[model samples]
Target chain A: MRLEKCWFCSSTVYPGHGIQFVRNDAKIFRFCRSKCHKNFKMKRNPRKVKWTKAFRRLHGKDMTQDSTFEFERKRNRPERYDRNVTMETLKAIKKIDKIRVAREARHHKMRMKGKKGIEQKAAERELEQGISLVKAPLALREESSLTLSKIKVKVSQPQAEYQMEE
Target chain B: MAAFVASKWSKVGPPLLDNLRSSRLLEPFGKFQDIASPGWNGLLFQQLRTFIQMRTKLKVVDNSGAKWVRCIQALKGRKGARLGDTIIASVQEAQPRGKVKKGEVVYGVVVRAAMQRGRCDGSEIRFDDNAVVLVNKQGEPIGTRIFGPVPHELRRKKHLKILTLAEHIA
Candidate 1:
């Protein structure tokens, strides 16, 4: 086999002595070792070095009429889709979403295990300081109020009067 | 692991913040406020240390948040004397060329121009807006006046410009 010229140094490269480097410029270069490749990289001037075959052929300015563009267009095509099947898929998606939400809630609880202590401490401090940490929707406001009343009853003896009357 | 890092930051970081916040040096200069969470004190310390170590190219904004202090060289004595031009001239006249050895106080100022942080917006960043003058012993300005070294490559091209917030300094 005829010897290949080293792309960087232009030296004759034996069969196993070098590897080929192809650049966006469409030039092919062979380097004897990584050291030469590194030195080539260390050169600050961009105009000094030449890149190899694949780089040049792949990167240069877009030539839309190139054969590769036709090949790429043929490889990627829209799938034949049916609208009726999409609605069925959407129904199945809703079921899947319900299950996914349940799983996410479990995962959320697991993640909260470590932070629960911190939250509890904050909650206890808020309670001791007579601060409200209640967060609930308007629909649950009456229920939350009842819950608060029960808590207040348990914490103090004011509810004993009602119980004795009953 | 996140908590550990946060805890370490809290415990180890305050002294540096204290240095930045309590630089009694800044009190007389201008209204330096802390907007940071833990505070500007820690941020200032970290920035100061980074500037001193040459780890960053970013210049420091003085306590007033107006001027940028680049190429900082600090000589210390008293901070009061270097406030006005008279003090700066007197100190320069008293000690001529070379280093003013014993009685010399250090002054630290930014060498390159300072732009108000938000001038592109309406709010201008100023040097003297909130600045403190650090002076040396016997009340002189010799301690610190930022100079773009005469013929040096890195600093020579840069000229010093002070961004005045108000007509405070005469």
Candidate 2:
């Protein structure tokens, strides 16, 4: 059985699963679930939806251009199967899968290389903006200390005045 | 001068009209026009190769207690009924004490046609069995639940109730 991709989310729609919508013009759209179908009915763009593969690809979160992806593409032409070729292809599939995984991991690492520094910078900026919420204001702290000392001097002066009066 | 121009136009106009009528470009639009017309009786269009017969057996896909039904007549057309078309069928088999009794005639909407239907996206779909869901005179389904996959074309045919009751739309 041939596997279909969901029109909305780019997810695999296995046989006997998912819903297919054929428009009046004869265009077919397969949805993996009711959620994708509902989103499609709402006229939401796949690239605009944050959770969809189209969104991730458009936002540079996933590898968009890769030779590895070419292997998974659906080809209309069937190849003549030979015993030796089949064995080689089976061996090649495992090797290709391993290479693809390694490439994908490398791509992800490259994409995330500066993520830590960017996150730290963002945290610093946030702290700079909201530092007063977390800690007392330096100027206010200094002023409060001076005010406390002044209050102590005033209290002492009041005691001296009371003592003089006594 | 006017008479001369009219005579000249007549010679050109008929051939042009004939060419326009015979052209392949307007063929699909003509089918669309038939669909758009309110009085369309499904006579001129033969979308499906095989049509349901008067005595054709249909598997009921709903829980309204009918297991099988035989078509007595297809409504709105003398030829036959395709997917999404409604037919008057007599209950051939049903569960005991069910809402529908055996031998009772009921209206049913065709949910799945065994013949393959071509889509505009260069794909074709065919169901394994010919199935129907019992409905009333008001075009609303009598069954509360549907068991198998139905086509999205039913929705285009304005069978929203069937689409809602369906487990899947293919």
Among these predictions, the greatest DockQ belongs to 1
Q: What is the number of residue pairs that collide in model 2?
A: 1
Candidate 1 chain B: worst 10 consecutive residues by lDDT?
A: B81-90
Superposing every Cα of model 2 onto the true structure, what RMSD results?
A: 29.6
Candidate 1: regions farther than 4 A off: A1-77, A121-166, B1-34, B37-170
Share of real contacts kept by model 1? 0.00
Return the number of clashes found in candidate 1.
31
Q: For candidate 2, write residues A43-133 as lDDT tens digits.
A: 6789998999999999999988899899889989888979999999899999999999899899999999999878766664444333344
Error of 2 at B69 (Å): 21
Interface RMSD of each candidate, angstroms, one decimal: 26.6, 39.4
Clashing pairs in 2: A26-B120
Tens digits of lDDT, candidate 1, A31-118: 5555444444454222343444333334442222333223223233565689988888778777766665666566557656778668
Per residue, candidate 2 scores C-alpha lDDT tens digits across B1-170 of 33343333333322233333345334544564444643224333424447777999999989999999999999966778877889999999999977999999999998887655555454455565678999998989888999877887887778898998777676
